[model samples]
Target chain A: MSATQTNDAPPEPGSHRRGLLWDGMLPEALGLCLVAIIFGGLAAGYLVTDYSWKQQSAAAHKAETEAVAQAMATALGCVADADGRSRAGEAPDVAAGPRTGRPSEQVELLMRELGRLPGLRSMHWTREGEAPAEPYREGEAPAEPYWEGEAPAEPRRDCSMVVTVAVRTLGGEPAGELRVERSASADAGYRSLLLWNWGTPTGITLLVFVALYRRLKRHLRPMVAIERNLHSCAQGLEQELQTLTLSDSLGRAAQGWNHLIEQLTQLHQRLQEAQGAEQADVMARFEGAVFRRVVDRLPIGVICVTNSHTISYANASAAALLQRGPDELVGRAVDKAIENPAVMQAVVAAQARSGAGLSVDHTSRDGDQETTLRFRILPVSAQSPSGDALITVEDISQLREGERARDNFLYHVTHELRTPLTNISAYVETLTQPGFDDEQTRKECYNVIVSETKRLSSLIENILTVSQLEVGTARLDVGEVDLTRLVRQMVQDNLAAADEKRIDLTLSLPPKVPKMRGDKQRLCILLNNLIGNAVKYTPAGGQVQVNLEVAENRLVLAVSDTGIGIAAEDQAQVFDKFYRATADAVQAVPGTGLGLALAREVARLHGGEIHLESELGQGSTFTIELPWPTSDQKVTR
Target chain B: MSRILVAEDDPHILRLISMWLKRQGHDVLEARHGLAARDLLQAEPVDVLISDINMPGLDGLELIEAVVPAGLVRRGVVVLTNRWDHGEIRTRLAAWGVHVLPKPFSPSRLSELIESLTSSDVTEPQA
Candidate 1:
């Protein structure tokens, strides 16, 4: 499911987004189209209303201009008639007052009446061909109808109209010409009204569009979040299913999606639990956390590699054995972690679940320390999702060393046993033969045979005891040991051997000796071995001392021999089973080399330890220390 | 009588070999270890050298190693060892034309080998 989702899901939701509504492209496009249509309609309405306003304002302006011209023409006609009557010697009656029949007075009266018309700038009358009729003016004089100081309050240059009207007499005959100029300031009010007409509707349409977009954005927010989250889930970018929930504010569709996601999460959890149960069933003894803990704490290394050829899990021991950091081996290629081709092939075979498991030993050297590791590669059952191949590594250097030691022990034992066997065989064969059978020679042969047989039996016995002690199969005859008596008896047993070499063999004991709880026979064997070795190794006239001291709640028995001592290099390994020193002095004496090892083992069984102190050509001492049992604790099991 | 040297660490084996060789009317020389045997050979070369492999001071192999090239023994060298598992040492001894006898061997067999050595003029075994 995750793979399919990852392959099918588009690049996350927010990338390359085109604005706030990018996620809902269809709605955004639709909203944009509607806004564009509304804006286009408002613009068209504005253009038409502007055109109509322009036409009405233009017509009203033309009418106002024509009316001012007509009023000026009528006033000029009255003035012209009055002037003509005065020229013809007749009195011209005027509405304001009686005329004096002077043309200037009549023109003054005409200026006053026409200037009162709101738009009239100035009026000029020409009689027949009179010299411009003095260019009749409104303010003070007719100077282009604009006074220098009072320029008609800054009138627009294009807002003025010029009208020429030919005046006629009262009988409708042409009398004089009248030219009138009027300011068209009244048209500015109409133009402002047109702007107001266009602006109000456009602003209202834009306001409505913005309000709708904001509302749509509020509704789309939850939807975009849900979409992005779904894409993330499909891509397997989110591990936590609960974090993919949509807000309840997003209505029923979102609530339904969240409910489906919740169910999916629960199903995933159940599947994992089922897998865990299967794994537990397969591993009958250990399950889940307990299995993990056991594997981690095991002395052997365990590495689990998935079918993908990568390590999925490596226990702590595995990491330590691999000499890597705790997490270094995990997620690395199996071949890379295990450099041996045989081991890698075994791992591959295990992962394939073919053939029986293969085990290989790999030897590596780091400086002076050489290590032998045994790798056992086994296949995990198919039900486990965690791993396909399980590789276990055990450091078998010590085990191999033990095997070598055992082989050496056998070789030495056989060699030592064969010496007496050869003697017994040669002597027995000589006895069977009838040549030169002197009684003296026969007596000698019988004695040699008997003694060789005894030597052979003793060697065999020592080998068995040492083997039993080493393998921990020897049953201890536990008893309260009288150290003083045991020491005396052991020393007494070795006195003859010491006396043969003319060595001074002595024993020293403290005033009080504490009894110890231990194996009596093994203790006797231990003391006899030490004391006998001292006597055997000491040269003629050398001293052999057995001292028993009880101090610091412990018993220390030390046997010091003034003889050819052990070399420093061989001292450490002297107690190892069947390890006879190759030194000439050590080899000069006949020994099976199991004495000290057996002695040490016996001491250990009694909760004691043996220590060796020796110098070449100087004397040697073997010290056995045991915890002095208290009076009440002397009870033996 | 041919002179024969018996080098052994064990007293009983040494005495038995000496007694057998002496009974055969062969002049027998005895040494407890390889070093003493080597000293005896250095003083006067023997016709046959019967040696044990394990000894103090120097081992039988080392003694033979020192003696064979120097012609310390006239006719043959015999090795008595219990280390049957030492294949490498055995191979080396074979290459040196030395005879090996594992321990607990027959006394009659040993007597036959010494008799052949004393009777033959050949210093090397026939291929």
Candidate 2:
């Protein structure tokens, strides 16, 4: 129902966390943070350890100096006693070794004691105011010592400290100075403890991290599975998300994802079902409303055939025209239905003709009736290969009969006019002959001939006019005209004709009638024909009535005649050219039988219709309806 | 006077053609159909052959095909027909150095065709 539902995977828990984890850059950030903590702690520890080590080394160097100073005081006291003293006034000669001075012997013993302390590589004592000597050892040269008035440098080994002390006799003269060197190895030992202190915790941390990673990975397995399934679904695969155990948050996430996928699948299925139903409804409407109700109900036959010459569909009218059932005609060759060679030829020619359309006349026997079929093949290229063809068959049998009747009427009329015309020509020729005499007789013959000639001319002119109307060549000059005034003028013009027939011609027009848009001459002809027919059909003392009224959106002109009316069946054929009713057969009515037909055609050319209402032996009323234009009609300048 | 051959099926139309030709001071020979027109050409010489397309037997195209190669009726030919949309007819007529005159033609059109055919010394008119 929402835009995201149509576009993306449904929302789920792992997707939400994965989105956060991606934003947080978790693994790289954790690794970098851990590395920075470890390195920063190591650096802080190194600096703190080094500072403490330097202080401890300075204390050790100070203690070593005091011990050497005590040893030097004892040696000086022994030398100051003067009992058994050496002649140089140094110390007593207490031992008989190669290098056994009391001060050197005592200094060597004190250096060995100082060496017993931890982190002491070597300890030595040097007497000042002498050549630099090594610390006195029995079998080794005396260790080097600092010269008097020279400051002792600090110990050089890492984290080591150095100290020196000066001793003097009671004579205010310098006896000797003691020098001590000590290393800061004890401080380095403490720093090493801190370095190895991280080992156990690191190992434990790694073990716990591995355990947690495996646990998290196990918990996320369902999420990964759901992800893969969702990917497949996104690609239009039908795989469903795996079921979850629902024991933890990740399990719940997987469960939620599975539920969402189920909901989406259900929605999609319902959408597909609705779409299918809609398609079926559309198809039903097309088949019911368009194909059956309309095409089948039409009077003209309709056959739709493919380019491969197979009939795809046929209407009921087509089945009737072809004298076959609808099922039998479908999927059958169109040429087999109507067994006419000319129709088949036209079909094949129409298919073969490149651009122009094909039309042909077919005569076929349907039961006892011989029907004339007019086949028109219109190529249907609206769709592809086996591009269809729409074959419309019109039953023009009645139309042919009407045309034949019109031709017969024209023939008879022409023949009838020719007789008097021939006689008049003969009379005029005789008068113009060389042996002719009598001017008065000639003049009388000429007058009779002229009248007869005029009668023939009028007959021919009427024939030509009707023929032009029937053939659709009559161009009506359309414009607005007053219907009441036009009808009044027509009635007055034909008053003498109505008087001769002794029919009471009446006009019943409203005081104000709407102006009609039409050709005045064609309207006059139409009105004249209707009025003339009314007078001709009515006997003496019969009544003929003409009325004009405005109906809804149209002007209706009704002409009612109290004459020998047409039968219900014959009323439909009255407007057909040259169709004189059977009732008029016994009556000696003289007419060209084209007046109503021409009038109907004239009304049709002006976008109007004509209807006739009549009953046998009662009367007839002919109504002509024309649409009235609105008052806002504008004329182009 | 030039001897002109006229081939027409309708007798009334053929008589009218012959009368027109005779009035123009030319000797006219007539045939009822295409086969008779061909026979006439084989037997005698003609200045031009004016024929109709839709004859009973041996239509105008076939007559032109027969006489054109045999050196019979070496003059020009003018075909008249009611079928105005036959593209094949026009192509075949042009191939045999023949001219086409559409149906419902006037008398003056026929006269002008005759005068042009006789006055031009060329055997075939350039298309």
Best by DockQ: 1
lDDT per residue, candidate 1, A256-318, as tens digits?
Answer: 767887899899899999999998787775567788898899999998888887998999988
Every model's DockQ, to 2 decimals? 0.49, 0.01
Among all candidates shown, the one with the greatest lDDT: 1
Positional deviation of residue A91's Cα in model 1 after best superposition, in angstroms = 99
Instruction: Summing lDDT over every window of 10 consecutive residues in candidate 2 chain A, give the lowest-scoring window.
Output: A1-10
lDDT at residue B70 of model 2 (Cα atoms): 75
CAPRI verdict (incorrect, acceptable, medium, high) for model 1:
acceptable
lDDT of each: 0.78, 0.66
